[model samples]
Target: MRESYSLLPITELKGVGARLAEELEQLGIATVDDLFAYFPYRYDNYELRDLTDVQDQEQVTILGKVQSEPLLNYYGKKKSRLTVRVLSGRYLITVILFNRPYLKRSLKLEDTVTVTGKWDRNRATLTSSDFHIGQPDQNAQWAPVYPVKSGVSVKKLRVLISQAFTQFPNRIKENLPKELLTSYKLIGREQAIRTIHFPDGQANLHQARRRLVYEEFLIYQLKMQAYKRMKRSSSDGIRIPLDQKRIREFVGLLPFSMTHAQNRVIDEILKDMASSSPMNRLLQGDVGSGKTIVAAIALYAAVSAGYQGALMAPTEILAEQHAENLHNLFQPFSISVGLLTGSVRGKKRRELLENLSNGKVHILIGTHALIQPEVVFQNLGLVVTDEQHRFGVGQRGALRLKGKEPDVLYMTATPIPRTLALSVFGDMDVSTIDELPGGRKQIKTYWVQENIIDRVIQFMKKELDQGRQAYVICPLIEESEQLDVQNALDVHAQLSQALPGYTVALMHGKLTPEEKDEVMNSFKKRDDQVLVSTTVVEVGVNVPNASLMIIYDADRFGLSQLHQLRGRVGRGNAQSYCILLSDAKSETSREKMRMMTETTDGFKLSAYDLKLRGPGDFFGKKQSGLPSFKLADIVHDYRTLATARDDAARLVQSPQFWQEDRYEQLRKPLIESGLTQTLHLD
Candidate 1:
């Protein structure tokens, strides 16, 4: 019954003919409720101003009579500009337009017109892209400006939104219980939508945004709590008891002492694995943190209990590195490690698969190929996914299904804020390794402008002359169909031409698995070489001697990716440096550069990145398994998010919300509006 309005197609509304219906379809608005959910991206304040009071270079709106007919001037075949001279009593102002010749017909001599644009004193003209034929609207506070496609106009959307509201004024239903809204001081869903689309003033808009943010966050928190409950009460898991003797030998082989942070996280993982319920834990450590050693400890304990362990990485290169490192870690303890990826072929692949199925291989490390259907496990009791954000929920689940609900440990180098951790990964037990291994030095980072490019190159040359390796990271961007981004290929060519004696290697997503492995291996061996690549090198390329890290157009990278790229360099004991080259003149871009230079703390950087860029950019599309909320900015409304999470945890704890028939209606609506089914939380 609650889905009736949302079920109706947008074509049923008035003024939505076939042509308009096709236009709306392009925006993913096929239903009546979809049109309503299309909120404004910004607002336009229509403040009326007197012509005499207009200041220089100010965006103002003035009403006056047209003194002369509009004149159109042309530069070339398709180039033109418009001018309309206006007079308000004794004051006079010339209005200029850039490309809108269509507005020429709307002007009539001596007709009162309202012009809204920037006022320039030097030219004594107002540069306007917007003007109308009506008198100035003194009472009009603001207007909703929505995002539109090619065929749709802002005026057309305004008309359609009004029609939708008129047709379904009272039909727009609220999903939250009335008491919940009253207790939390949140407005009803219908009122929130109305005020958001057609806000009366700033205060009303603020209230409208508050209500929507709460709703978006609440839905996400509910899913988190639901998954948490499932993990706790269910017993379909293998209990891997702690092995003190085996663990002692495993850590004894390490070259350095373990940090207190690492020890604490290992204990948490051990507790979860020893339980009856399945263990879904997230282990996050800063770059070079001893997360790998902790994971090895868990694998060792799992193997001691006669259970096979599988570790999945996002990239083939990373998978290979893990196999090598893990093999070394378990060599003295006589634990066998197998490597499986798409690159393995013919007899080698068959041998690994047979060994894995027959329980000969104690631990398996590979890329997404580990989740394939034919990859059977003998006694897979534990599945550890490194950099878990790189895989989707389905990929993680497929690996777990190899053995009935194997205990899952998700590891990541990307650090997020604690509030965000509580909101997004609430379903999983979280453990953090904040301390780096002893003897590692903090990376010296600098944000360089383009004018000093030559000087920066010389510094890198000095590093190379000193027998140290360096990494030059290119920006990853795709602006439009007609424009190609400056990717690794272009940068590699330029760098090869600029640096004569040094060997420069190229690697990116377009390279084949064998090609990437070959290039990475070559880069690792050559001390005088520089690897010019993209973010593909962010995770797996770990050469300790590689001390210099330079990212071109560094402003294009988010704080997290930039931090991960920096992590690639400082993995060794030698003093390291990260240089960011950005010529961007924007304040936001410069601010990010400043933040990078000030600190190397991933947690603090992530929290700042959340505030600088919204949650969408923080988790991108394919990575970070989290589906972004449409309206919730994790930075601004953090307090609201905390409240929502607490309320959801409380509500889902008791059986009354799920068992009572009255509250069942509320649960279904909220779940359906979000990506509950996509993440397999259900």
Candidate 2:
């Protein structure tokens, strides 16, 4: 019976015809089981309350008697107003509803009813959102509100869900082991599925939600654990011999001193290098925090041990930057460094590939070109990916496969919150470089409206006149009708006209790699005093002489991105400045600007950004490898996530747990959720 119902189509349900079925399919509900799994985003608390106790604009439910008949009046086209007067205690409250004229029948005179909505204090009215003909029981006070589309209304979905419950009882099978259920004090899967929709009582709803959320997090953590296990097993962990004296010599050769944070992270990385298990670590540091030096140290260690090392970047310019910096750093030791990018073609590319394959290139750096089929490595021991979030898992995985159990280091300049890191990069151990190097002055940041442009230009001219360069970043390369923000071309033209004496150049993502490199080279050499570009220079175009950054439409970007752009400056000895230009009316946008002015802490800004824009949008959702759980939220349910991670680690260690009869139900869902491709579930 359960199997039959699980396969039952939406059309088989009474009153669900073709159009409604199409709408249901839009919500990813095709079969009965899918509908059962579709949980509500939130619930309306229609618990009974007093009219006098309601605050202004507060959603409250009042049990009252209808003092007057509901008057239905037509307003604009397809719009109707239904008004009624309800008597509760000694107060007569006007109940206003919109476009729900059919509800007039339920608001008859002298009838006791329950109304739920926002209370408008000025109008002395209760704008009713939902109502019941009679006072519902305590268990029925909470109403489920599912995420709906244009054609599928919440009321209709509720009816269909209720019908599904009645038609498909006992269809939900218990997937969790009895030990887990007892240990967590969780309800059964069948009860959870049933109560999550109708919600019999508050206690039952809490228990049901807990069970479902735990299951979602547990399964996600299990997938992460499985991937971690696959990563360890696929590579024969070759422990790199760590010579502390050689490493100290390399560090001593550097011109500058390393921060305590850098030293700590390097210690962690070296420890991982010496371990038999492959090093799967994420190196997260703020912009200009000297992540490159740490990566250079790790590469030095790998190469000194008679093995090749490769570093991958997201963009050609960033790749070139790494190659240039590493070339200068490794020159003392005579360690060969090679560059491979989209533009390095024909003879040069072939020669580079040959050197790479023959182990002549001790340290190789490039964009995605490094992961191509032909770029073979003779002894690829270490793999480093700069700005790792920009590359997808498959790209990184492909590069790792080129070597025999290479130690992999994923580096990101964008600071991620620790909890977010655990959820997204849970497969890898995380190391953070929290402190900036000594004597690096903080960039003075300011937010200004677009109206104060002349003053900002004067300040820019003063800074440029003193032999400093400036970076002007726009959100768009070309003019966008949909967005009111300034484009690169317009900003370039404006800046050129304003600063006629200074050499102003333009760069954007639309430009070719050679063109971008040419423009960047000009800027680096101080030939261009002002460089107008898009977010292309947000990553790794380092120019120490440039000290001023003016960002237009700063509110259009996330806080982390704005920080990254700001980081382009303040890399030199002199003090730097960043001016944010926005005429944003929203408080959220204004708050972002204010926060940027408040502190230079990237981790704090990232945590706030994670809350403002969820984990999916923090980085690109498709490439993040973070799961889209229906009931579990990684931010709010982090404790639950941690517990689930521990449980998953324990469960995965049990050999062939997927094949055991006790976990048969669990394994079916894991495969169905698309873990079979990554995990050896068989």
What TM-score should be assigned to candidate 2? 0.85
Instruction: Kindly list the per-residue Cα lDDT of model 1 for residues 1-682, writing each as its tens digit.
Output: 2222238888899988888899989988888888888888888877777767778898887778898889999887888899989985577879998888887888888999888889897887988857888786554557788889959888888888888889977767777777788997888788899888888888888988998888888777887777666566544677777777767877877888889999999889988888877899999988888788899889999998889999999999999999999898788778999999999989999999999999999999999999888899999999999988778878988898999778999998988866777766777878888888777789999998867877988898899888889998986533335533456777778778878898888877788889989999898878439998878888975688899999988988888889999999877777899999988679999999999999999998988888787776776656556646666767777888989888887877755666555555457744565423322322
By lDDT, the best candidate is 2
Q: Count the backbone clashes (under 3 Å) in each candidate.
A: 0, 0
TM-score of each: 0.82, 0.85
The CA root-mean-square deviation of candidate 1, after full C-alpha superposition on the true structure, stands at: 5.0
Model 1 / residue 146 / CA error / Å: 2.6
Q: Candidate 2 lDDT, tens digit per residue, 42-158?
A: 988877777678789999988888988889999889899998998877779899999998887766688998888899877879888887778766866778999999699888888
In candidate 2, how many clashes are counted?
Answer: 0
